[model samples]
Target chain A: MSVLRKIWTALRGSARELGDAVVDANSIRIFEQEIRDAQAAIDDSKRALTGVMADKMKIDRRLAELNDLIADDEASAVKALEQDNEALALEVAQRIAKREAERKEQFEIAERLASQIASLRQKIDAAEKIIADHQRELSIVRTTESVQKATVQIVDNIAAQDSTLSSARSSLERIKARQQRLDDRLAAGEVLARESGEQALDEKLKAAGIKGEAADANAILARLRARAES
Target chain B: MSLLQDMTLSLANTVFEGHRFDCLPISGEQEVLQVQVSGLEEMPIYVTVTDTQILCISYLFKKSELKEGSINELNALLLELSLPMPLSSFGMVGDRYVIYGALALTATAEHVMKELTTLASNAVDALQTLEPYLK
Candidate 1:
């Protein structure tokens, strides 16, 4: 009976430890998703920044060429006007002035465009930094999670060990209970035999003005029965 | 006219209160004018001065959008310095005016209010420096 009880106790302990392990596994999955989302956002910002910079460079170069042409044309018109070629001077001056006006307009347009480009670049840079910061945060979170999981696993192992010890302890208690019950029955039988043997002695002692047994055998038997029932 | 000095004095007036400007001293012949605004969040306002006007080329703020009242204050300030409201004909690319201000994004009254304030402040400060050049 003791051997059968030990086997049942071991099975129950294993089942309880397995339940704890399943719970720990689920928590790790949630941490992994958070990391993935952070990484995706960082990638998107990088792509957008790259496209913006490329376009800005092209516009800048175009503006620079326009600026150089305006300068060259104005200088030529001045030189032509100084040479006393009235008709040629007027045409050159007018053409240079028109181009200069166009260049000025283009310059203003370019300046505003450049300002907008710079602002966007700043935002992209800030976003990129934020993403990097989040990545670092994710790393720390993941590391902490891993350590927690390890700790849980160690705790679970300790719990499993404790469960086995508890099972062994319970089996011992059951055995002790069984032994106590058997001992009570033996004691009852001995008491009955002693009572029968002492019946003659009791009648003899009654003449000497003393009771045969001071202790109540029936009361002791009742106590043993109550203990066994409990 | 030294473009650098003109811009620096303008920026100094806009950012620093009660700072008397003697004259803008030119450091070198460069397109970029770097103005240092001293504070916990030290902002560097960059300016590019041209023949016609001074453009607040770029400025950096942490993450918040600019507010409209702030923009109005900036415009008023720039008006005091004779700088006009920056034209929107400027195309945006990266952290350019449009993107940083979220100009291309869905426009709400609140959003516009926020963006305009910062933009106006930056433009006014930038144009203040260019005022001499513009005249």
Candidate 2:
């Protein structure tokens, strides 16, 4: 059966049970098996491709030898005709024709082997892509299982501790409350800092004899003292 | 050690996007890293690493938390809004509705950090948007 059909069956089974751990586990197992099978098939194809390449190489060598033989025979036939030896030239021509036929046959075999190798490579690439896709989907399924299980523990912990993570509404309320508190704290801090900032500025001005009633009184006292000294 | 366990140790001292994470290892069949980002303590994102990918998930709400008649509407709305939500999507793991994001295993630490931050913030936004649907 197809991988998609298997996935569909698994999904339907899971939905029927609504969170059945067994079905989830089985689906994961099936995906793992599928990936393994694809990898094995790719390995086999690679081996077969090696064999096809070897055969093509053998055919190529034979074709090269036949071409050389055909060339030598044609040269001999031409030499015989130049010498006015008709029967010898005809015999040499027949030998060249035989070599040509053998080369043609070998060439056709090499072409078939080349095409077979190409198709095998394409099949390997497609199988590799399918394995990759299946691995990703399996990863997602496993991650979901881990996440749900982890959250189950968290839920149990929440129930045990009786904390605020029981529901979304309560958690949101707590989050809002925390935010509100932080905002209030910031606002209060700003007010206090502003008040103290003003006080510090007042003290600095008085000390500098710049802009305060205390500074005016000090100026009057200084003037009286200076006048007395003069 | 698994990749996530190594990350759990490294991320303890690491801060991303001005937010620090407190990585708590949840021991189970598959070790899950429950990373609680600073300032968003309530919405912790779970990190699980497989050979192929690193997945980050944050629980938005549970099935029981949805209003009696709002599950279908909420699911449809979530599907529509998921497209516009940057770098994250909504899904369900068992009874809990979650917002999640995924990254390749070969992703850099910076990439993982960015994914974690985005997933955490996305969960908060999704929860707030889904407030009307909750009980």
Candidate 3:
């Protein structure tokens, strides 16, 4: 079966809950095992390919030897016929025919072995691709697990600290509060400085025997309008 | 040496694109690099490099943080959001939701840094976008 199908099967079998650590761990193990199996299958195919290649080479050598023998025998037969020796010529012709037949047989074996090697090589290439895919998937699974586990540690560490790391909402509120505090301090400082200045001005007015009332914006505007009318 | 340890050492002195990284190794069965990026210090990116690929993850929130009855709605919304988001995807690691990106093992340090930056910023964006669904 394909690695994807195996993973799908495993996933289907364990899709009952989110964050099922056990199932995820088991799936990761299965994926690793599947990758190893694929590598082994590729190795087996390579070994088979080498064996067939060796056989093809052997047959190729035999075919070459047979060709040489056929050529020599044909030449000998020609020489025998030239010398008017019919029996010797016939014998050499028969030997050449036998060598030709052997060559044909060896050539056929070599062709078969070559085809076998080609298919094996193709299979190994495909298997290698599958293994790479499996490895990629396996790493994702393993890394997710690591990240999750590490997060647990990190979160625990953070929680152990006194509000060092908090929720996003809390962090946002904290930032807002920080800015708000700065604004409040500035406003308060301005109000205090104005109050002290007003108090000193009121004391000076009392020393000069003049009573001062706090001026309102609307009252000042009414006075200005009255003066314009007059 | 482990790849995580090597990366930790190299990243210790790395200041990329105006952000400095502080790498810490999370102790466990497997090595995980917790990279705290400057400015986005709240969201740390977790990195693990395998033989085939490099995986970087930043936790957005936990399942417990979701408002009551918003799980399905949030999940659907996350699925829709994943398509338009570049270089990152949303996933759940156990109970925690994370934004993660993956790269080939041949990816350069610059690529890793880019991924980390994108992942960290994406995480903060995800939290803000999903705030309505959070309690």
Candidate 4:
């Protein structure tokens, strides 16, 4: 039995993993499918539950009629006995006994239907909760996937933009040139002063590189400082 | 007084509080201060003292040197935070993006220190935030 249980557990775990993979790879599609599935389940459960409730209502109506008939039969039998009509009284007594049997049957039916209605309501509640949880998980998964995609795209864009950024450096150079043209005060001879402003940081980064691999910004920064202090 | 002049005075005053910095001889016409921020490692910042503004820049990694496709996330984050960051912004310096702060020349020692501190702290935070994305 234990070995059988172990196999069952393993199967369940594998099935869960397979489901997770499907959800991860096609989260939106899975989410929509999940919504559709949950709605269908809810509809089915509602139908079943509605049938149970309708049975309960029908039994309750019959029980009410039986109760009224029981009261009328007792009153009529009592009146016949008081009038000294034994035959009439006995006939009423027979009808009263038959109704008593019917009332018992109707009562039993009502009780059973009531119990069924309660059980169905509980099942529906549980199913609804499961559906809600599925929807919540789907939302969170979609959000996380979006963030990951956006991150990848942004990195690719910048890597691709490296050449265009050199254009930016030239634009900066132009801005500096224009500034030089405007002021015409600071000697252009101090070219290193302006260009080095940008390149100093560049050189420092290059110094921190490990075999052309991008070094951590923090590590490169530390190296630059160590060089400065030395 | 010139922008560099006030910066020199503030540096002498140790106004940047705990951060380390040194004067730089341009390799040009603009006098610059190099500030070293200590975090998980030492980070380099180039401070250019212009006639109008003081630009404090911390050099990040080179775009060319990073493994292909590693920078998309970092770029996305920078783009997202650029506008919301009131004190500093990311700019391309050569092939690298540097986090920098711009301050008015007439700004007081207290103000300069604040700007420098914010820019440095943010750069460190950014490095940590982007560490996972780095290849």
Candidate 5:
């Protein structure tokens, strides 16, 4: 195949792989965004829980102050009753008893609020853990995406280098072919002329009283011996 | 003026008269011409010519080894022509032809050397008129 064709094919494959990697990376980004949103929600819930706990503490302090006021009024009621002020003493006792009941109810409500705050805090902690785990997962996905991008880039670079090398090799081959054709044409004529000259010289040597036949006979005998041994 | 057109007429005359090589004027890139000198057989010497340079780009001959005499002769011709000889491992740069001495000499020492010298002399004469421009 041609170099251009090969390069095109390689590029198509690389693009396909890169497309898949992009999709995976985008999916990871979506997961990452979701985790971030969840973490934000967890943070908001934690802030609300802090407010609930503070409110519960405030209610408990109010209940304690009401109990202290009930105690002081009750002591004053007992002294008034001992001084024979029955009506005043009765009114003070009734007020103290009413305040005590209110304090007890407030303490119960505060306990319930504290319980709700604990439950909400547990939910926030669980959500945070999930977000943290998702964040870790997102990081892995990002790392994978980075590696994939590098792989694609490396493949592209290799393909480019290969194409350049192939083009250089093809050019060199064409040059060599042209040189060979010229060399063959020039050498063929010279070789023929040399062969004829050699033949003529052999003929002259034969006519000049040189024993060429004797040398040929010896050469034939040597070839026969070598062949027989093989 | 472009180097190719400026030297076309002189280059044609020199190639035909001095070297007995055929000249064909080229049009694109520059006013260059291609010259072909017929050797012993159908093998022809190929060269490219312009006003500033005459290049023996290709030749035909065969030998396993190159001689030192041919190398020295090529260097001398390059000096006379005021052209840089191509390094063996380098490629062409612009209008200059890159060649390796080892490869040229190995292929055909006598023929390569002779053609190189003739081309070099022709180039020197053609570009001599432009010496003041160079300085």
Candidate 6:
């Protein structure tokens, strides 16, 4: 990819990450806002429907008035025709035709408005149902998100505690080994000191007749060797 | 003129300076007039006029208007305010919840207007308290 394309891709990825974070943070608020907005839209749809219906009613009334005017004028036209006043009959017929034409136009407009209002109402109703479903889904996910986050944090804490416990156990073993080594070395030094002290005491005792070697060939050999060396 | 018609004319002459008084279009043994109040938020109140008394009823809301999830809460709120509402108490007509007040036909026009206004006000008040459940 070109450098610009790569940069654009990175920006898109970051934007998605940011969007995910925002959704995670404000999921409930966004859902509530959607509900509010949907309700407002529904209300607007209802108001528009009401206005259109009013217009249709007005048109219907006008059509009714036109019908009455046409009927009266037609009656007058028939009377004039019977009276042999062709000019008056023609004028009345023309007036009735004009009224009829206006009525037809108003009726068509009213029918169109009625249809538009019906279509709009259906669309708004569908939107409300969809928003309601979204709200239900969001509520369920909210609980799941809370519990999921809590459990994840708990797992992380336990993992951290396990590491600390492992180090503590290893430290305990190392300390115990050091203690045992110290104890062993001290024991060996004590044994040597005890043996040397006993030997020195034995020599003193032999000279002073308190402690002495065994009276055997080894003692004679040791005396002869000492005399020879002297 | 009929007793109800006389009562209505007297009512219009006495209390309602500019209120629209139209007879209800029901073929029954009784004469009823619908009183459209002079405010945008107020709904039209219906008065059943008999030989002896006038019962004015104003619609509060429909059972269908009550949200299913908040029905219990709305019912509880209705029960809470059932006894303490001023002038008029909550009543039901089929599936419609209403508020109403009654007066003898012999009652003064002021008394009639008071009862009608009381019913309307109570319905409006109940709607305000139960708005959340309504939505």
What are the root-mean-square deviations of the candidates from the true structure over C-alphas? 37.1, 5.3, 9.6, 24.6, 28.8, 36.9
TM-score of 1: 0.31
lDDT, candidates in the order shown? 0.44, 0.80, 0.75, 0.61, 0.51, 0.62
Answer with 3 or 4, whichever has the higher lDDT.
3
Better of 1 and 5 by DockQ: 5
Q: Write the per-residue lDDT of candidate 6 for residues A25-121, one digit (tens) a residue.
A: 4645776787888888888888888898898889888988888888999899999999999999999988988888898898899889889988988
Off by over 4 Å in 1: A1-48, A155-230, B1-135
**Residue A173 lDDT, candidate 4, scale 0-100:** 42
lDDT of 3 at B42: 62
Q: lDDT of candidate 3?
A: 0.75
Place model 3 in a CAPRI quality band.
acceptable
- How would you encode candidate 6's per-residue C-alpha lDDT over B39-59 as one tens digit per residue? 312345666653334667665
Report the TM-score of chain B alone for all candidates: 0.33, 0.95, 0.93, 0.78, 0.31, 0.78
Q: Which fraction of the native contacts appears in each prediction?
A: 0.00, 0.48, 0.17, 0.00, 0.00, 0.00
- Model 4 misplacement above 4 A: A1-23, A26-38, A155-230, B1-135
lDDT of 5 by residue, A1-230 (tens): 33234334533564455414433445556677878788888888888898898899899889889978998998999899899999999999899989988988998899899889888888888888877776655543433344334333433443355431122233334445656888998999999999999999998987875649876787889999999999
Top DockQ prediction, candidate number: 2
State how far residue A215 of model 4 sits from its true place (Å). 73
Per-residue C-alpha lDDT of model 3 across residues A19-48, encoded as one tens digit per residue: 234334666677778788889999899889
Best by lDDT: 2
The C-alpha TM-scores of every prediction are 0.31, 0.79, 0.67, 0.39, 0.36, 0.33
Ranking by TM-score: 2, 3, 4, 5, 6, 1
lDDT of 2 by residue, A1-230 (tens): 44455445655563443323423466678778989999999999999999999999999999888888888898899999999999999999988888888888889999999999999999899999989898877655555455556667666554466553567876687678778999999999999999999999988987887969977888899999999999
Please state the Cα-based DockQ of model 4 relative to the true two-chain complex. Answer: 0.02
Worst 10 residues of 1 chain A by lDDT: A163-172
